[model samples]
Structures are given as C-alpha cells and as structure tokens.
Target: MSEKEQPRLASGLAQKVVDTIAPTIDRHVNIMNAHGIIIASSDAARIGTLHEGSVEAIRRNQIIRVAQADDTAGTQPGVNLPLILNERLCGAVGVTGAPHEVEPLADLIALTVQLLFTQEREHSRSARRAAEARDIISALLAGHVAADVIERTLDAHGLRAPLQLELWLPRSEQDPLLEQPALDGARTCWVGLFGAHWRLRKASDEPAADAPNANDRYLIGPAAEDAGELLAQAEAMRTLAGRPAMLPRRELEGIWNQDIAVAVARTPARSLKYLAARAQVLNQEQARTLLVVAAASSMSEAAESLHIHRNTLVQRLERIGQVTGADIRQAAESLRLQHAVYARIALDELQVF
Candidate 1:
C-alpha cells in the first residue's frame, strides 16, 4: 500500500517522540521510518541515516540488538524495537546503550510511541469530523444545495440535519472564541464568522435549549431555524443595542416592540443618515434622558426612572429639543425621535456613518 494509505510514522511525530523521550532517558533515542531511515534522533547528526538494526527489527517484526558500535551499518551498540500500531509495523525506535542495558528502555519507548500514535489518530479523526460538520452547515445555510445531497452527506458523516442556529458576537475583539472554537460537546458544530462572530449548529437529535450561560463578553443572538435567520436575529440585536432610545438591559429581548426600529434601520443609507443626524448631536446625558422619556408612560414616570425630580426632567427635555430640533413631549415627535435614535445607534454600531 502507498505510504499515505498505510499507517506510517510522520517525521514530525517521530521527532516529537524523540524529543519527549530523550529528556527522561540518559541514552540517545532514535526513531526510524518503515524504510529504516532514521527520521528522528537525539543525536541530530544521525538523522536521515540508515539504521540496519532498526531495519532488521522491522523485517523480523521483533527487536534486534547491536552488541557494539558499528556492529551494523549506521547503528551503534543499542537495542531496536519495532513500533506497531493496530497490529501493523509502522516504524522502529532504538536506544543507544549496551544491548542488555537498553533492551527494557527500547521496549518502553516502543510502547510509548505506539500509544502516542493512537492518540494522534483519534485527534485527526475528530478534526476531520468537525470540518465535515462545518461544510454541511455552510451548504445548508446557502439554501441551494439539494435536500437529498445534504441528507446523503449528513449520513456519510453520521450527523443529523441541524435543528437550530445559535450565534454569538463578541463584545470586544479580544474574545477567545475568535481564536478557538467553543467546546459545546460532540453534537454541536461551530462555524466562525468574519467579524469575530461564532455560530453553532445543533443537530436535530440534541436538546435545543442547551445554550451556553449568559456572560459579559458576548451578546448572544436569539435561536433560529437556520443560520440565515440566526444572522438576521443577530443583526436585529445589534440594531437594538445601538438604539439610544432603548437600553438592551435584558440578555434576550423579544421582538414584540422592535419591528419598526428594525425596519427603520434597514432603510436606505441616505434616509438613515438624515434621521440619525438629529440624534447624533445629542450627548450621552441627553440620550439617557431621551431613552427614559420614550420608555415611560408619563413625564413623572420618566423623572422617577431617571431618579430626577419631574421639574429637572422638564429642563433636560427642553435642552434635548434645542439640540435635536425635535420635541420629545408630543407623541408624533417622540415616535420620530425614537426611530431617529435607533437609526443613529445602528449606523454607529455598523460603522456605516
């Protein structure tokens, strides 16, 4: 079989074995590929040379002992043991010492190398499965891949159709999910997005309610039926976050009172800019006062919400109108100002301004 088709010792892996074992054992360690070429050795100069002892060990599928230096071509006084993985001989590991002195060490080294190879194989398999999941999710979200084709691919990978999409956008660029995938167990597959965003595709067999607990660093998007809808939910959440008239105080907010604000945010860029222009001039204090007034049922409630006296709130309202040229007292102007504030916030969050 071709080397790729058969289990063989990779040069990097062989080198890692040598490096790891060399420190613990005082004797030199060497790892040779199936062809008996030294791939890794504690003696750096000996690498890439032939080791006849290792070659004999592999050919006989057993250990071979060299009694003295130069007893075999490119070999020293040592013991060489064949490294077997899955009952197949893949390589040999040799330890440099008297034949009887290093025989036990060579055996231990062979066992360690075999175990490490098995572990590496498992890791490679898991990575391959995760990559398959990512591809399936990408195709599913594209919404043009044929259903049967998706189903066949899912079966091939032992994955089910994704039931829901979960998204997370970092509060800052330094979030860890940008560099590593979140460990949500085996059933969920994660895909990373361009803006340090991450989305999870939970297989239909997994429980839908098992989401990560709320945290300060990430703004979680509402769960949706697919990635596309999940992304839309994320966009809506961002728009709501940007609204000066609304405070995103809750971890998950319903879309009940947010339809108009979302629609206004999706409007043409020029219209959004025009609406945002008036509200953008308002400073932080003015914006906070406006938010309370728009959310409260009455001016007294707005004052209480702001923790200020009603007369003090009236003064702030007057200042706000002067800055924005829009009255907050009248219902029509209040509604217009709310939309304008939403547009303004969305623009800044999206960096579209």
Candidate 2:
C-alpha cells in the first residue's frame, strides 16, 4: 500500500497490547509497522529494529514462519502475521516460539491491533470533519462565500439548506456547554467554534429546543436564506447583549425587531474614535469615578460607593465632564456616555478597534 494510505499503528497502544498479550502466551511479542520497523515489543531492545520475516509477511500479506535454522541477523524463530485493517496493510505481529505453538498467539495479536487501528482511524476522521465544519461556518458568517457556493458546500458536507442558525456565546472556550452531547445529535447538524462563540446550524425539521444547553447567553437567529440575514441578526444581538442592562440574561432566546434598531445605533467611526481617545486620556482614578457616577443613583450614593466625600465625588464628576465633553448630571447625556462605553465594549468583542 502507498505510505499515505497505510493504517498507522499507534505506538503507545501497540505497546500496551504487546505487554498485555506477552504474559498470556509466555512469548516475546513485537509489533512492527508496515515499514517492518519494530514499534512495540516485549523485548525493549528490539524496538526500532527491522524484522526481515515481518517485512516479508507485510509484502506478501501472508503468515511467515521462521525456523531456528532459517533465522538471519535481527530475525527470530517466530510466527509473523500480517496486520490488515480494511483490506489495507497496516503492520505485522510476531510471537517468538515454535511455529505451531505461536501462530495462534500471533493471529490474536494481529486481530487486536487491527481493531485498535480501526478505532483510532475513526476518531481521527471525526476530529478532521469537526475542524472542516468550523472553518466553513466561520467563512459563511464572515461573508466570504457566495450564497450559491455556500449551498453547494453545505450539500457536499451532507448538510441541507434552510438551516436554523444559533450563536452561542459561552463564558469561555473551555465552557462545559461546548461539551454538551446534543452538539453531535444529527448528521445534518453542524456545530463549529467561531472566534468567541460556537455556531450551530440545524435542519428546519429539527426543533431548536433540542439544542444543547449552553448555560450562558446565546442568540438564536431566524432561519433565513444565504445565512446573510442570520449573520446580521447575530451581530445585532451581540451589540445589544454588550450593554450593561442586558449582560445578566442567560439567553437572548430569539431575534427581535428591536435588534435592528440597536445595530443601526452603533456609534459612528468618528464618535468611536472620540470615545476611545477620551478613555485613553483619563487616569485610572478618573475612569473609575466616571463609571461610578454613571451607575450610581445620586452623587451621595456615588460618593459612598467610592468611599469618598460627596464634595470630592462632585469635583471628580465635573473634571471628568470637562475632559470628555459629557455632563454626567443630565440623564440624556449620561445615557449617551454609557452608550459610548457599551459601544467600546461591543467593538472590542467584534475586534473592530
């Protein structure tokens, strides 16, 4: 078989298998890869050594029995069985003993190794598919692919169109929600890790209630064509969720019309820069004072929370207003300042600034 198509023998697993089978047969067992290089053996010194009989067995895909008289350098009197997985030559198993006595043990070891190879191959394939799914979803969300191309790509990947898309903003990359079993439920369902969230797209027939519980804030976009509308809605929900008042909710549930309003209200480029510049100019104490004043009910409460006299709090607020061009005492301007803060946070999350 070609090298790329050869089933690999996991050395560590092969070693464990050899160790487990060696004692039962009372014979030294060696596992050799398709190249005839010993990877695992009860006799540690034999590892990395080439076995001529094992190499022949792999080449011929048949058992080879080496007699003591026929043994050459690095060759032992043993029964060497070719390891085959899915009709592909993977490796060989050798048991050192009389041919009649060790042939059965060699066969058993070969079967065990074949089974292990199959399991590892499946695990590797699944991981590869998951990564491909992530890449495709990220590209779609980023608007890198045309609608027709996306549909074709989805079909190629065994997913149908008119898919329901959900954006999961987990607390962290390692959040337990990412491990939920529901993520793997349907072959048609695709779950992928996006920049700061997990994106899930499911068939229309599949109910959204069946999705895994992320146990954190998530936005469910309406099912739409080209996934373009869903992407926009997801961004809008993210901006709204960035606001302080909405930060505590565990889930956004579904897209709302008001999300468009929030998205449209995003601070303009000039205003974003102005807010950022103002923040950059503030000292740590001034920044904290501004935050406290914006969140507090009154100047007295703000002073108490900051552990400062009311007069001192008033002076800090006035100084902050003079520098940032926003009067904290007025409700409308205070709300504007808070919105600017939220805008900065949203932009940071979106990696826009």
Candidate 3:
C-alpha cells in the first residue's frame, strides 16, 4: 500500500504493514506497541489484547522469539521483530507468514521503522534535555538557584521547564505483563513491542507517592541514564537494600544488576523532596537500594541489618564487593554497590504478592 492510500491504523504504520501483508501472507500479522496494543492486525480481533512476548522485550530490551511451530526441521518459525532504531527499541511489527515469505518485507519494514524510530529518538532526546533543564531550575528555585534567575535563564535558552514532565515504564522483563503493573502505570508514553515486551516510562512531573502505587512494586526514573547509567550513577552510596529470597540461583545470577524500567516523576515543591526524588530517579542504584541493598548507615548499621558484627559487616561488604561489583567501603561508595544489584532483577509487575 502506498503511504497516501494506506488505512489509518490505530497503531498507524503497524496497521498499514499488517494490512499490506494481507494481500500476500496467509497467516496472522500484527504491529504492536511495546505495551501490546495492536497498532494494526490482519485479524481485527488481535487489536486490544496484550502481546505477552512483545511486552517483555520493551521491558527488558532483550531480543526474544517464541516457537510458532516445532523447529526441529530447521524452520525459523515466527519472528518477533524488535522495531529498533539507533539501538533503542521503539515498537514491533509481526508477520505470521513463515520467515521465508516474510524475509523480503524485512528491508521495507526496517526502513520505515528507522524513519519512525528516528522521530521517537528525538522525543527521548527532547525529554532528556527538558529533564536536565528542570533539574537545574528546580535546584535554583529553592534559593540554591532562585526563581528570578530561573526566568532569565529560560529567556536566554528560549525554553521553559516542562512544569509537569517525567518519563516512566514498567520493570524490564520477557513476560508480556510486568511483574509490577504499577511500573507501566507510572509512564508517560507506554510502549510495547510486537514480539518482545512492553515498557513504560513515567512522565517527568508526578507528585511523590502519586505514581502507580500498588504496593510491593518496583520503579526507576530519569531517562538520562540508559542501562549503563543505572550503575554508573551510583557513585558509592548503598541507598536502602535487601536480599533475594526464594529465588533460583540461575535467576539470581543476573537479577542483581539489571536496570528496571523507570519513569521521571516530579515532587510538588522544588525542595528536599525534589532532591530526594531526583536522586531516586537519576540514580537507579538508590532506587534499587531502597529494595536490594544491605542496610548500613555505618558499619554498625550494616551489622544490625544483617544480624552480624561490625567486623563481619566489613567482611560481608568486601564479599559484596567481590560478588556484585559494588565497592561498599564508605557511605558514598555504597550507592554504586547498591545500584549494580538493583538493575539485574527481572520483574513481573502483575504479581499480587
């Protein structure tokens, strides 16, 4: 279908692509958001339901594929396309047509996806700039920076703080549903993929305690940091923390350092709360530390949290350093240690417990 003659899909191009496939392909085809919203589908019924695998890719940023049929015969089976542009996942388009039949369209899909994702990337870049500006203005407005100066700075920059801005998404994962739904609820633009998974990034200006609060939840924020930044931002503070319980050894191996899907939420006033919230948003380790770190304001604190002696705490801190790549020798150093572990866990946002 030509661009002008295409059907307007709820998902736009995904619908167009899927519709185009209808002329040649025999099986189902779908284009979906990272959230599993069927942007378009050859079969109309596929639209609103969640595409579990796609959602997981958005969450985990991992490439995933499920077998459409037995693959012992060297068949490629169905492929869940990760609509990625510039290495960041945008959304996904799927073809139920066998891989061989669908291969030809890959280039076309890739080209269009690149174009679309270029636009999406610009959105993320803009959001980052906006967030950084807001952080500066927020810092200034409380007398640390000053409101009058804030106006002058904005005037000079030809911009204003997106007074109510933030980004958030669900915890990263391979499951269609987040282990914690509150995470998705926290995002500004909800994204799901065709075959991967769903991801949501929270808006920039949400009141604390106002994001998706289902209790027993997970959240990270501030789009400035990608996967690497989650740990890099730690700098040395162990935020607040705990250990994995009843988790499998294999699952536990990589769970301690995975970056969870996060959103940017603003505090009501640019005060200590905002600073605190920003720390949580900007430093993913602190976010995870609140959930995964070994408790310790000092050697004494660590000892109490772990039910051990201060010396033992030091020994354990050394061990934690060896195990999780966190250097917990000082208060400032604990954050890095804390964040490394925080990013590795895969969350299922839908769990009740």
Tens digits of per-residue lDDT for model 2, 1-353: 23457566789989989888898878989999989999999999989999888889989999999878453475667898988877778789888888998898888888888787778776776676677667656655665566677667666665564555555555566766564432332332236443445454655554565454545655555665655654565455455544423332232222112432264346564565565553444555775566566556777987987799999988887887888787777877765555554445444522111
Relative to the true structure, how large is the alpha-carbon lDDT of every model? 0.65, 0.64, 0.42
Please give the TM-score that candidate 3 achieves against the real structure: 0.28
Error of 1 at 53 (Å): 3.6
When sorted by TM-score, best at the front, the candidate numbers are 1, 2, 3
Q: Candidate 1, residues 1-353: lDDT per residue as tens digits? A: 22346787778888888888888888899999898999999989988989878889999988888786773355578888998876788789889889888899888888878888888976786587567657765665555676667656655554433434444444556654444533433343456543333344444454445444343223344344444454455556444444433323234232113665567756777787887776777775676577667667788987876689999999999988898888777888877776666676656632211
RMSD (Å) of each candidate, 1 decimal: 7.3, 10.5, 21.9
The C-alpha local distance difference test score for the whole of candidate 1 amounts to 0.65
In order of appearance, the predictions have TM-scores of: 0.56, 0.55, 0.28
In candidate 2, clashing pairs total: 0
lDDT per residue as tens, model 3, 1-353 = 22243222236656666666556656566666756566777779868877665665567765445556655643235555666655545566665545666645644564665666456645655565445444432333223444455445544443333222222233344434433222212332222222122222333544444443333233233342222222222211112111122121222222233332111111122332333321232233233233333333455653554456777655544554564444555555565433322232212111111
Better of 1 and 3 by TM-score: 1
Candidate 1 wrong stretches, greater than 4 Å: 1-6, 19-28, 42-52, 59-77, 85-88, 111-159, 172-192, 203-262, 273-341, 344-353
Model 3 bad stretches (over 4 Å): 1-10, 20-27, 56-67, 70-77, 103-107, 117-353
Higher-lDDT candidate among 2 and 3? 2
